[model samples]
Every structure is written in structure tokens, then in C-alpha cells.
Target chain A: MGSAPHAAAPLLEFHDLTVAYGGKPVLWNVDLTIAEPCLFGVIGPNGAGKSSLLKAALGLVPIVAGSVRFLGLPLDQVRGRIGYVPQRETVDWDFPVNVMDVVLMGTYGRLGWFRRPGRQDRDFARECLDRVGLADLAGRQIGRLSGGQQQRVFLARALAQRAEIYLLDEPMAGVDVRSQEQIFRVLAELEAGGSLVVVVHHDLRTAAEWFDRVALVDRRLVAAGPTAAVLTPENLRRTYAGQLDVLDEIGRAVAARGRTP
Target chain B: MTAPWLSAMTAPNTLVAAGGVAAVGFAAGVVGSLALLRKRPLVGDAAAHATLAGVAGGFLATGRRDLPTLLAGAFVAALAALGVLVLIRRFTRTRDDAATGIVIGVSFGLGIALVSGLPRWGLAGSGGLEQFLLGHAAAITGRDAAVLAGVSLAAVLVVAAAVKEITLVAFDAAFAAAGGWPVDWIDALVAALVAAMVVAGLPAVGAVLVTALVVIPPVAARLWTDRVAAMLMLAGLFGLVAAVVGTLVSATRPGLATGPLVVLSAATIFAVSLVVVPRRRQEGS
Candidate 1:
């Protein structure tokens, strides 16, 4: 909850991080750090472990080596101050929960187990719903909403969490143009409010325009820093065209056998 | 109402049994709603099928045919089956559906073998072990009904207390885990509650078909509502109605197995709901 000590330590830091699936490494040793609140993007080719970076940082997946620290502390000690929005496709949209119900989940982490959300929580959820331009659809079934609206609902849920940092995975993958703009605007507002917003995005064109800082990853850290500095043609080629053959072959072999490569 | 119908409804023993079955039905629907939302309805089927083995083992180990002892054994077996399912999923490349099928087929087969062998083995007082195969509510005494009702009530309370957490985990496990909620533990809790309801239902619905008591009502209720809370309430109501109807109908017919009657009644309600509810939702939307 406290600000980074003396503003010297990075707000979020990943050191020598490695991740594997079924004992086969997918993400190799990588190191990265974010020192302040900004619109940060993790951009990579498909299957380049972009999503896995977020998952490993949030502890959704195993970290084979190294550590992720938030404000110089372990994730467990600072989880409540962190909000996460997983990929839109990670959940079943047909689940029997309304828009409000899904958004209310953002409050569950802070409310802890067995404690119901109170009037203030409901009001806050409504406020978040309004932020995503879906306040009127609060009672609608999630499945009935369009893809853009569904993605916004997830954003609203993360907003209700009221965290100091946010990690969003593929929030704009299937989103329409207008919804994409709207999502970016809300994320910009979050950053304006002095919260760190880290987005795992796929579109390179949008990444160039949207992010103040970006990290290009292809199984490992290719380049990172200011978007203009790190998103150069050379860095882009290394990230996209320079996919490691050994990693690719091992990944395919592991996937074919349903084991970790 | 007919005279016999009135008498059947008013009879003390029948009323007690009906009340107990109603509790089981309500709890099953409530717990099963979570399981259904989690997209693991068949997990209950595996647990239910495995309960037969436990019932037989309970009788053999405790040398008693009481509801508590048999159900205790049944619960243990149900958990064991779930554990096996988890192991198979974690250790093997077999898909979830195939693993579930393996557990269901193998455990149920072992159960049938044990129950069928009990009588031939000439174990004293093992004559009624086969009752658990298809279920006979007439065999449940008032004491047994009370115990069943107690377990059902407890299960319902557990669901109510943790509805928010359970729903979060079911809907988005990755988000829940990132938020520091113990997703695996919540899932296990839901599974355990389902196992409890399955065992509670064994006296009336039996191992082979008890899963119907848990699954059908929740699926039917889903057709009627978009909200989790409403779906849970409607599912419980639907389950209660089915349990009561099945119990009473089976009471009137002496030789009918309560399991089939209960399942048939639930399926009928599900059919009706499927026909009636979605149309209304479509019109409203």
C-alpha cells in the first residue's frame, strides 16, 4: 500500500524469471522492471509467451526461477493492491452471471472470504460500469453482450478492485474499434490517476501509438524501454522474425505429446 | 384430491421421508448449480457412481446397515474417486471426458461386483445392500431421514456462506488466483459438498442415478434466470418439487425404485422448463 520506498525501487520488477509448462521451458531467463506508473505494453508474436509473462507475474502459472516483486515485496503481501483482467476468452461468457455480478467480483478480493459486498461496493461497481459505458447493461446476461461490451465488463471488474497496479491480458484482442478506443481511454484515465497499467496486447500498430513504454518479447526479452526507442525495426525483427528454432521445435514436440517442451 | 393421495400426503412417516428427500433435493440443486457453472457437472456423476463401493465397504467394515455408517463410507469413496480423477488429469495425457468415463465405468463396475457378491458371500444382514443400487425410500427410517436432512442443511449453509467466493472461482479462476483467493481449495470445497449431497441422496436416489438429482434441476433452472442467485433458488425449488413428487409417487407404487422415479420427475420438469422458460426470455429480450 505504501509508495515505493523513497521512489528508488521499481514499482514492479521481474528478475531472471523463467517459466515452463509440463517441465519444458516456454519462457527463458528474462529480466524487466517498471519504475513508475505508465501505459506499458507487453507485445510479442503469437505463442511468444506474452500471456505467460503476465500469468507468471501474477502467480497464475508457475515461475520456474527468479522472482516477481511488486513495490519491492512478494506478490502475496501486495496482492490486494494489484488488479488483474485475464484474457476475454479465458472464461465462458454463457455463465449464469449478470453484468453487475461479474463486475462485483472485483470487490471480492478486498472483501475477503465470506463477507458480502455492501452498499458502498455496489455503488462503486455501478461507477465502474459507467466508466466502461455499460452502466445500463448492468443487469444484462454477459453472453448477450457483444465482444466489445464483454471486454469492457471485465475492465469494469478490474476497476472495482481499486488497485494501485493493473495487469490486463489481451483486452483488445477481439474488441471493435470504438470499444478499443474506449478501453484505451479508461486505461489512460487509470494511469492519469497515478496507477500503473500494464497491458498484454497483440496489435503492433496500436502498440506503437498506445503505449508510453513497451517490452517486445519472443520467448525472452527482445527489447524494452520507451516505445519509440525499443519498437525500432531492428528490435521488431528480432522479436518477430528471429523466433528461436530450438525453442520452436521443443515447444512443438512438447505440445504434440501433450507435455511440457 | 383423492382419498389415497390425501392420506399419503398426511401420513407421518411418508411426510418425514418426503421432507428429508426435499432437503436433499434442495441442497443438490444448490451445490450442483455451482458445479454446473464450473462446467463440471459430470464430476458429480463420477462421485455418485463411486458411492456404491463405499456403501458396500461400510457394511462390510462396520457390520451395520445403518444410513450413517453406509453414507460415511460412501462419502469417503466419492472423495477417493474425485482424487483419482485429479491424479489421472495431472499425471496422464488423457482428456477430462475420457478420465471421467474411466472413473465412472471402473468404480461403478467394482461397486456392482461388491454389492452382488455380498449376498452370495452369505454375509448376515447383507440382503438389503442391493437397495442402494436403485434406492428404496421405504427402507429409510425416521432417524435416517433426520440424519440426511441434517447433512443437507449443512451443505446448503456451506454454499450460502461461500457463494461469492465459489462463484468467483467458477467464473474466472485465473483472476481469483491472482487476487490471492485459493481457487483450488474453493473448487475442492464445492466438490466435497457435491459428494455430501450425493451421499445424502443415496437412500432415495441410489448411486447409479443420484447424479440426476444434482444435475437436472440446476440445468433446468439455468433456462429460467440469468443471475447466479436466482438460478440457485429456482434450481433448489425445482429439485424440491421433483424430490417430493418422486418420493410420493414411488410411495404409491410399492415396487417402483425411487431413483428412477425421482430422475424421471426431474427430467420432466427440465423438459417443461426448456419448453416454457426460454420462450419467455426470448420475448423479453
Candidate 2:
């Protein structure tokens, strides 16, 4: 199903994708496709396998069934064309590396092994840092940065990858308002530049305002389409009400829909 | 600093011994730092402890205690221990800490039993085998030193070549895997290097505490630098200094073991760094 005959294949596609951990499925039969460039959101409540979807696509997690394709090719064939920003909590920030050292890792995929990043790579990394408003902090240790600054550093690293498809997992979580705005702006720019930016987001209000297309996922994908059509009250109820314990929080997210600016 | 020891340092054998131990220390530090960054510091410890059994097995199999033969056996033993660890993790319900503890206790105990029984069993040429328990650098031959130095140089060169790839996996394995880097192979390379260093360190630091050879310098270096390249260099330097100091100091005293002295010197470096390096950096968490 992922390999179509036409040249104009979808940018990214997850066909009958199922992700499992220890023999138990977390995400089941997710058939989501992004045909063009856009700011796409994977919105879900806590424990809804939102991150799992991205992990499956990146081959970080084992795909129990089905396959994920990027531009009609398997993940390995198109890995160089994709940039990934894992969650901030996924790594130890106290590692003995400065910001510039980390951002240079983005160029590693292209550089291959043994050859060190040279003058050109440094200049490009600095430009990436500049894009994320972190050029001055490039020499500082990653641990010394604020939460928002760290997230921005990660964004700069992803930008340094120079990829056409960017998959960011919870890039805005725990970030200050200014950092979130800057991140969204950079993602919007990527979309405008004919790149696809897929994000795993938790906030409903921002999902409606920021993403051109949003897929509400809860273990299985609930609804997916344009932002206005997919984020209806009925879909939100179905997505959020799966876990009866979080009903109050679900109601709050639903009630705040009108207040979305 | 003593007159007798300073004079002894001029002796060709003493110089060779010190040089070999120095290489082992430097390589251990370089390899150990990568394991430390990977958050598997104790993995080296497990391999270090297992080397004792290998030392015993090597001597028993070859009927000779040459540095290369014994270290070859030790390397095989260390790899076997790591392989067992992987099996446990893959097959059993045991936690990692518990598995590590199991490997250490069982391997170390077997080593002590074997070494102690060698003399009682009347095995020929087993008189000095007990020296391996806590290392005795005074007995190291020039040939042994050359072998140690050779292995150390090789380990260091391997790290120098792959430092970038190793650092990437250490920092963000998921990102590296996503980028199509062979993360498992990199991790395996690190493990194999650690085992080699542990085997090479068996003569100078011994099996009981050789883990310090790999662990202390990297940790101490971490306190002094925020850069990975600088950290690796500092770690190698610290390990070299500690190995040289321990070997030299043990030379001055007849019965003193080299392992404890080496560990103490590394501990001193760690202590000084803890006191001197500022803790003013913000906590990232």
C-alpha cells in the first residue's frame, strides 16, 4: 500500500502501522499519510502512544506490523532526507559537550565516520544556532542552558541536518512562551520552504491554531484531516474519553476549544 | 622522589615496566571515558573482575605466565563475561544491577578459589600467581611491558579513529539510529575496547581493582572539562600519571601491591578535582 505507481507519492505514510513493546501493542493500525508539505500535528492525551508513532517511523521502536515510508521509500533509504528531534528528557543534558559540539552532530550523518567537522560545518552549525536564537550560547555547556534554551539547541541541531522532512517529538513541552513561538515560527518556515514538519503535540488549543493538519491519536488514530475538520468536539471526546480516569482533563481540553485564539 | 627509587628508575627494566603500565593506564582512561559517557561505567568493572578467572585459566592452560598469553586469556574471559551479561539481559527476568552483581561475585570468587588452590594443588610454576590478585609491577619483564604497551597503543588508536561515532551514540543513541548509524556495532566496539583495556591492565592494576584504571580518570576528567575532546585528553593524561606514580611508588616498597597504590593515586586526583573545580554550573534537570 505504501508503494504507489505514480511519481507523486505521499511525502510520508504509515500504512497499517502497529507498534508493540514486550509483545503488547501500544499503537495499532495507524494509516496516516501526509501527501504534501505542511505543519502536521500528532495530538493525543498522555499515554496515547503519540511518541510511539514517531518512534515507529524513525525505526527507534519495533514495528510489530505494517511499514512506514518516506516519499515511497523505506526509512533507511530516505534517512538522510529526514531530521529528528527526540524529546528533551530522552538524553542526559549533563554530558560533557558544549552546544556547538552537539549541533555538529547534526552534520555527522552527512560527514560519515572518521572525518571531523571542518570550517564549513562549523559555520553552518553557527547559522543553525542563529536560526534558533542560540548563536551566542554555542560555546556554553548544554547543562547550563534554561529549559527553553535547551529545546532551542535541539532545534538548531535538527536544522543543521538540512533535511526535507523534520519529525520533532514534543519540542514545545516545558518550553516558555517565547521559545514556543520561535519554534513554531521555524517549523512554519520549514513548511513554507516545501518541507514537511511533523510534531507530536499535546495541547489542543495550539494544535488548532498552529497545525495545517492534525491527527488525533489514542493508541489508534481517532481522526485526521485539516485542522478545523479533525478537531471537532465529537473526535476530541472519542480520543480523550478512551481512558475514563482522565475525563475531567478531557472536558477541560474540550471546554477550552472556544477560547482558542 | 626517594634516592633509591629515583636510582631504580634509571634501570632499563624499571623504565620499560613503568612505560608499559603508563600505556595501559592511558588506554584504560580513553576507553573508560566512552563507557562512562554511555552510562555503563560498571560494565567495565564486571569485565575487570572477570579477568582474574581468565588470568588463572590462561596460566593453567599454557603452563606459562607470560603477559601476552595470560592477557589473551583474560581478554577472552572478559568477552565471555560480557557475553554472559548480554544473555542474562536478553533471556532472564533479572535486573541489570543484579546481573552485574552476579557476574562480579561469581567470577571473582572463582578466581580467588582457583588462585588459592594452585599452590595447594602443587601445580608447577604457580608460586607467583598470587601476585595477580593485587598486581605486583616489580616482577614485570621487559617483554611483558612491550606487549602491554603494544595493546594499549592499539586500543588508543581505535578510540581516536571512532571517537566521533562513539560520542554520537553516547549522546543520543536514538538520534544516531534514526540517522542510519550502526549504533549496536558502535556499542559493541566500545564494549570490546573496554574488555581489551581491562585485560591489558591486569598486570599493573590487577583484577581486583583494575576497574579503577578505566573509571577514575574519566570521572576525574569530567570534573575539569565540559568538552568531550578535552575530557578524553585529560583522562588519558591522568591515567598515565596515575599508572606511572603507582608503579614507581610500589617499586620503592617491597611488599606493597601496585593496584591499591594506583587506585589511591586516582582517588587523590578525583578528590582534588572535586575540591578545586567549581560546582557553579546550573543543574540541567
lDDT of each: 0.91, 0.89
Worst 10 residues of 2 chain B by lDDT: B276-285
Question: Can you write out model 1's per-residue Cα lDDT over A1-261, one digit (the tens) per residue?
Answer: 355455567789999898888768778778999999999999999988999999999998898788999888889888999989899999998887899999999999889879999999999999999999999999898988999999999999999999999999999999999999999999999999999999999999899999999999988898999999999988888888847774876566546655434
For model 2 the local lDDT of residue A91 reads 97
Task: For candidate 1, write residues B1-285 as lDDT tens digits.
Answer: 578867765678888898899999999999999999999999899999999999999988999888899999999999999999999999999999999999999999999999999899988788778789888887878998999899999999999999999999899999989999888899999999999999999999999899998899999998888889999999999999999888988887568888999999999999998788758573434
Backbone clash pairs for candidate 2 read: none
Candidate 1 chain A least-lDDT 10 residues: A252-261
Q: What residue runs in model 2 are displaced by over 4 Å at the alpha carbon?
A: A1-6, A244-261, B1-5, B281-285
Candidate with the greatest lDDT versus the true structure: 1
